[model samples]
Target: METIQVVFLTVLVFFVIVTIHEWGHYYFAKRAGILVREFAIGFGPKLFSIKRGETRFTLRLVPAGGFVRMAGEDPEIVDVSEGQTVALRVKDDKVTRIYLDRLDERSGVVRGEVTAIDLERDLFVSLDLDGEIERFRVHPQALMISKGKETQIAPIDRQFGSKSVGARAMAIFAGPMMNFILAFVLFAVCVQMAGVPKENPDKLFVGSITDKSPASGSDLKRGDTIFAVNGTPIGGNFKLMVDIINKSKDTAVKFDIIREGVKHSVNITPAFDKESQSYRVGISADPQTRPATFMETFTIAGKQMKVWTINIFEGFKKIITAQFKLSDIGGPVRTAQYTSQFAAEGIDKLTFWTAILSLYLGIFNLMPIPALDGSRLIFIGIEAVRGRPVNPNRESMVHFIGFALIMLLMVVVTFNDILLLVRGEQ
Candidate 1:
């Protein structure tokens, strides 16, 4: 049953995130007249499939990723100007390329030249003034073109760049916007399930201070009750620790502590342990666990949701900046190990952490990296600037590269997760 819970949570979160992402594209693409070939979850071999109109929907074996495959995702749009020949223009540059086939032939190749590029649209809009335009439907290779007697190869246009910039931008923005919508909806629902908490006075007392730690130098001693740090009141250990770590990078904190029924104050610089990605002022708590108010429970959960969202973004930033190594990343295996560890701590702890994890998943999916909703937004932003869509071929290539990089990162993280699980440390 424990294992079942982990699987269920993982699948539930993954499905929610991926569905929102793909649906974003599916919604916008249909509105834009783009033909979607497949809306799929997972990768590798297909586990199940359903055909609806022109779209083939499938659940694949892998649960880690998904895609929305559209025909216009390419730079070249299909044309049948002549019964035996098909022609296409470079979507952005307006250079036309032609392909020829015998009356009985099913496919043929065309050659042409193109110049002038649109980075935002990924289109090559104009060719050399005197260049020839050759269009093709077949013969993907061996296309040629020239200007002023100087010849150049003309590449086929994928329809992605051919669409209006607004259409292209909509397609790109759709995924991230969907993620945000999911997050907002989930957050609001969680809010309704849990109400906001009232501000409670600090009752958590420091039971120990590590020797030679920053807290020791700052006048913090055993049995000191911490009321606030750097002017931020501490309602509990989670809030106190989070506030400290957030400021650990550069700020020096002043602690308002009470000992022996007398209030005293101290200043300490929090130190960062790069490995844990957390901060410490060298003090330990006797785990002053408080009973949640009927209202505090909901508020506490909602606040945690907010904290987890911030943490997820910070983690992503650190990973990108190399402060967090890829080897430190965790996958489902690590997540399960953590779930198991917390489950043994009782339902409250497990439930709290689960809420945090859910929020993490919700926020992370909204990022704009390639193969991510966030990354799709970047493309959308570009289209908005260029007043036209990005070239389909270029867009596909960029995403392909991003996908490869993401896969590599995932492999590393998964290895790390498995290692942590084996050691029973996650």
Candidate 2:
């Protein structure tokens, strides 16, 4: 039952994050007058779908990722000319399908049976349209159709490629921007509920002691109040005590502590940790916290967001500089595991971690990698500079390759995640 609860919570968190991310693109694309054909959550065979206005919203089987399909985002081009009979599948006055085969221009009407429809590729074919048999490649953009004459083309305003560079950039950038917004909101809520830390300078209270460490070997224990270090009085200055201990580094330091109202002195030597490049006595101090006012909550949350944002960038820099190992990178599985663990802790911790995860997602998506929003912005930047869009075929190919490489990386990361789980790392 506990396992089931964890799994459900993990899935819920993943769904919420992905849905919001994709909705950001859908919202901005619509605002920019770009025709969004489908706003889908997840990938592969869709479990359900419904058409609303010009968009078909869908939920797919796989929960790994989602996407917004926009018109003119691909390389395909539709050409319509005079003297050629084109059969169109119309529904509710909308051109739902287009026939590629040239119709007998003499036939005023053609009839055909619908053979197949490829939703992913947006391709459709019919055996006949009003007695005319033809193959048709469906146009992705929504269109109005009239029977005998040439099919009315999708409006230029509805095409993504026709939008201004600023509009295009906004649409592409909205996904990551929404992520940051989500993180801020979540963090604000957490602060409002749990308050912010209010550190005490005078009192030094040990919260926990690492087992088998120098502090643990001594008379020091959790909840012990330290009044002074060595012969010098701490005078409630926690920083002073910390500075002395850390500066001592492998040197013995005498601590004047009060345990259950009994004054005692204990000598503890600090150990140097290579990873953090810090000296520690293995004792964690309790941080004082107080309820924050509404406005104060937002201020704290904003500061938290800024700090986390810088940390994420620094982490990426470390990875680039080889200071971080790729093997430590977590994928979907690891994310789900962490989400489940945080959820098990309590709502406060869960919300805190969610904010951090959202921030990370936002920053990571902004990386100028192919198949990502940042990569799309790069093309838009080129268009702005050149005053014209890049060749559709070439741009599409680049995105395709980038997408393939991203998938390969995901597979590798996922495999590592599973291996770590098998090895009991998580």
Candidate 3:
């Protein structure tokens, strides 16, 4: 039952974050008059669906990710070859719908082997009816049914490319922008719960120990005040102690501290936080905090959000400059595990972790990688400078290859996550 709850919370967190991200895109696309075919949470087999106006909202089986499918966003979306069969829903003597699949299963529609078709441009389908060439006009808002899913046919006007470059860029960029907004909101909530922190370098103590931290398996405990490291007096500078630990270079360092009014010492070896590209003994400062002023909430939240974003960017830069390790990165499985662990501690920790995840999600999507919003924005920039858009087929193929490679990376990373979990490395 506990395991089930963890899985449920994990899914819920992902659902909320990803839905908001996709909603940003959907909202902007709709405003730009683009036909949004689907606003789907998750991927793979559909679990449930409902249509709202021109858009179909859906829930899918996988909890890993979601997408907003904007029509005409991909120029290669509708392709019907000559000599193909199609069932049409005609109205007012004109084609109102096109069924590209399961032709025998559709009733009250005309079945014809298409000889010539133009879903775009002419918006008509030509057929050999009784060996006579006949063509019928298609409706602007014609529905196309394929694999039992109905999507409105995108005329040139309703296509994403037809919009101004600004609209297209906004539609793509809004997803990440929403993520940053969420992180800021969540951080504000956290500040309200826990007062604003005031660093007390002079009064350092063990606040908590992570499960895999070197401090955990050592004599370190909460409330232990450290006064020296390897006989180097801290001298009211917490940074001095940190510098000493970092300079230790994974060597065992002796810490002199007073725990429960008794002077004692402990030896701890710092571990390489390869993911962050830093050396650490796995501890954080337990700073003294005071109640925040009402106005301080927003101010602190913005500052904290900015700090988290900058830190994440720097971490990625270090990871890129250093030797890349597969274990240095976590996939869906590992992230879910971390989410569960943090949530189990308390709502404050959960909120804190969620805010960090939101920032990471926001910043990571802006990396200019293919198939991401960043890459899409780059295309828009190129179009603005070149006075024309890139070839749709070429852009689509590049994104497709990037997507394939990403999926492959997900497989490898997920495998490593499971292996680490089994080996007690997680």
Candidate 4:
């Protein structure tokens, strides 16, 4: 049951992040008038699908990452070779429907051998019928039925490549943008849920104690001010207090406190924390928190976001510069481990972890790596400089290679994560 809970929670956390991230792309793509073919969650076999508007939303078997499939985002498009037979439905001299494999025997459908076509520009199909060539106009919203699957033909105007560089960049960038939005919203929610923390200076007071920790069973109470530790005056210095306790090495330390104006002393032992390899009593200093005003909440969240972004970028820089080896990286296994660990603490702790993870995702996706949003932005940047788009095939090949390298790294990281788990290293 515990393992099942861990797995479920792990998938749920990833699912939430991926869903929000992909929805960002889908939202912007639709707004830009691009034909969104499918918005799918996960990979592999399809579990079910719900289509709305021009997009077919699908939930696949895997409970991992998802994608927003915009038309013309791919290097390959619909192509018809000469001397091939296909059925078409024409209305007002325009080809409204093209049947590739199904509905060929249906009435009012004209079947002919294809000689030439222009699906993107002129939207016309020329066919050789009984030794004479006849051309028919293709509708802007023509439906192409192939193997019983119907997909609306994407004209040049409705394709992703047709959009301006800014619009295309926004659609591509929206995935990471959404992740940042989610992080901010989660940060705001968590901040509001747990009162906003205000730093208190010139005072070392107890605010709370960790459950099952030494301080939780001690004589320390909330609002009690620490005056000294083991005969040394702390003088409202929290770090000094911590240093004294850590140096104690699981030995009982004397704590002098003033509780409600009454001076008292208590003996508390700092237990060893295997995770940090340090001694800890698990007591927190007074945060001096109060209910944040609506306007103040967002301000605090924004400031917190600044710190998260800095740390994320610094970590990426370290990894990119090879300060640490790639094999030292963690993967989904490590994430699952942390998820289970934090969830065991409480919902609030888990929520804080989720927000951090979301922020990391948002920032990581913006790195200039192939197969990432940042890489797409780089291509767009080049297009802006050159006054035209890059070759779609070349761009696709670069991304494909990048994706392969990423998968290779993932395998290595997963192996390392399991090894670390067994060896008990963080």
lDDT of each: 0.60, 0.76, 0.84, 0.84
Kindly list the per-residue Cα lDDT of model 3 for residues 48-139, writing each as its tens digit: 99998888999998776788998776754556789988888899988988999988888998888899888767899998776888898998
> How many residue pairs clash in all the candidates, one count each?
37, 15, 0, 0
Give candidate 2's error at residue 118 in angstroms. 22
TM-score of 1: 0.52
Give stretches of model 1 more than 4 Å off: 75-162, 198-309, 336-391
Query: Backbone clash tally for model 1?
Result: 37
Ranking according to TM-score, highest score first: 4, 3, 2, 1
224 Cα displacement, candidate 1 (Å): 26
Candidate 3 structure lDDT: 0.84
Candidate 4 per-residue lDDT over residues 334-380, each given as its tens digit: 88778877766556667778888888888888888998888989999
lDDT of 1 by residue, 1-426 (tens): 366665565456567677777888888987876666689988879999988865789999877768888765544333222222232334333433433333233233222233333312332333233355432222222222222121122232424445666786678667756765555555544444433433553466775566567776767766678777777777565565556746665577777888888988887777876776867776766445434554654565556557767788788888788897555778765666666655543444455555556456546655666766566667767767876656756777887888889888777778888876688664
**TM-score, every prediction:** 0.52, 0.69, 0.75, 0.80
Q: Which stretches of candidate 2 lie over 4 Å from their true place?
A: 76-153, 198-288
**Residue-by-residue lDDT tens digits, candidate 2, 157-203:** 67788888898899888988988999999999988776656655456
Give residue 178's lDDT in candidate 2 (0 to 100).
86
What global local distance difference test value does model 2 have? 0.76
Relative to the unseen true structure, what is the C-alpha lDDT of residue 26 in candidate 3, on a scale of 0 to 100? 95
Task: Between candidates 3 and 4, name the one with more favorable TM-score.
Answer: 4
lDDT of 1: 0.60
lDDT of 4 at 210: 82
